[model samples]
Target: MADNAKWYVIHTYSGYENAVKAAIEKSVVNRNMSDMVLKMEIPMETVTEVTESGVMKEVERKVFPGYVLIKMILTDDTWHLIRNIRGVTGFVGEANKAIPLTEEEVAALGVEKHEIVVLYNVGDTVKITDGPLASFMGTVEEIDADKNKVRVVVSMFGRETPVELELDQVEVVQP
Candidate 1:
């Protein structure tokens, strides 16, 4: 039985995140399982390292030292393929049931790009998803696709206040 593709965390040997990801990815392709195994990532961030001599260099550092994220359709075959990877320890789930990541969790982890699909048009009502104006409902005043920004007129303190937000920061409210 196959499940919808979602992000699942996997435990790995310390410092072997990349190696395990490569092995699983290669297996997925070699087995012609592109539809099953979709994405794999070892979340990393850049940091400046300063040496004793005051030489500063930017380096990519793993955010989660011993884990990898896989976006795949969960199934018996896929599970076996992932488990058999050389450096993979196990899935980051209770017992043997793999827990898929929540959309908010994935966003917080910065593992995937958050896509905002807004059906609301200019002069339509929308909801603020993130930022200081979170949960505030407002009307769309303007949209700037080039800048990926949207200007919404939100009612505050008995007045209409215009707010600027990223395209991904607002959602269309269904009536």
Candidate 2:
């Protein structure tokens, strides 16, 4: 089932990352294995580079060369589908076995992002729910949803101290 899908890393030839990904994708589509093979990705990052002409340009570079990540529900048929793809060396695991990445590993790799809903906004009173400031009540000074950061002004030692915390670290103070 889709709930069983997990991310696994696969190795390919030095320059065959794209080729291997395409082959596996095409095969999945042909076999109607969309439910088995949920998603595939070649992690890439954009970097600003200075060209020979002194012009600045953004270039997309592979985060992990010769590696592709696939989110799939592991099974013999799915394993064989990827194994038979041209240019694929094997899955990154012990004795050619595929191991699904742990939840922590997946989060560290930034392969998936969980959406967060912010209930409190600027000027609202919130209570710190995490970190050293847990149980501390503060007034929201600023909220940056894009960066998942919030600036809260809390009264400490009779003085107002502004602290920055993660968006999820605070909750609206119920009336």
Candidate 3:
């Protein structure tokens, strides 16, 4: 059902991701826009930090702050409803045109789409495919199986550092 809905990014006022998502959900329900409006989400990641008491705490924080992903079939009425929602600024795909996310791009984002592979696991060795650490090899420190993300340590400036990256962005290389 979610895959049938076209994905679009909605820009919201800073610190208003949840509010805009809720407002859109409520509007969709009240106006009976179920056919066009499917699902809404605020992408978040868990982060651990030390508190004043010297205790480590894990909290959920937005991966892309002030942005919410909406899976829906865009129509004039649906667009009107979403645009009029409080805290919503605009959509990200186009200025005047509503460009739907391609299936591959949406799938790569690991939102509302199934992962294409389950090849790598924690302790598996992989080579970075892109980014600054490109071509560097590292062992997977953690695996976000659901989101298809992994934390790997690469030698940067002669120091080993861990960095989070998408699963698809790395290639598993046997040692």
Best by lDDT: 2
TM-score of each: 0.72, 0.82, 0.62
- What lDDT tens digits, residue by residue, belong to model 2 across residues 70-158? 99999999999999999988999999689889998887778888778999888999999999999999999999987779999999999
Give the C-alpha lDDT of model 1.
0.89
Per-model lDDT: 0.89, 0.93, 0.85
lDDT of 3: 0.85
User: What lDDT tens digits, residue by residue, belong to model 3 across residues 1-175?
Assistant: 5446798889899999999988998998899888789888788889999999999999999999988988898878888898899998988866756678788877766685654675878888899999877898988899887766789988778888999998778989976
Query: What lDDT tens digits, residue by residue, belong to model 1 across residues 11-53?
Result: 9999898889888878988999988988888888999999999
After aligning candidate 3 to the native by TM-score, how far in Å is the CA of 3 from where it should be? Answer: 7.0
TM-score of candidate 3 relative to the true fold:
0.62
The residue ranges of model 3 lying beyond 4 angstroms of the native Cα positions read 1-4, 115-175
Best by TM-score: 2
Give the C-alpha miss distance for residue 113 in model 3, angstroms.
Answer: 3.7
lDDT of 2 at 106: 85
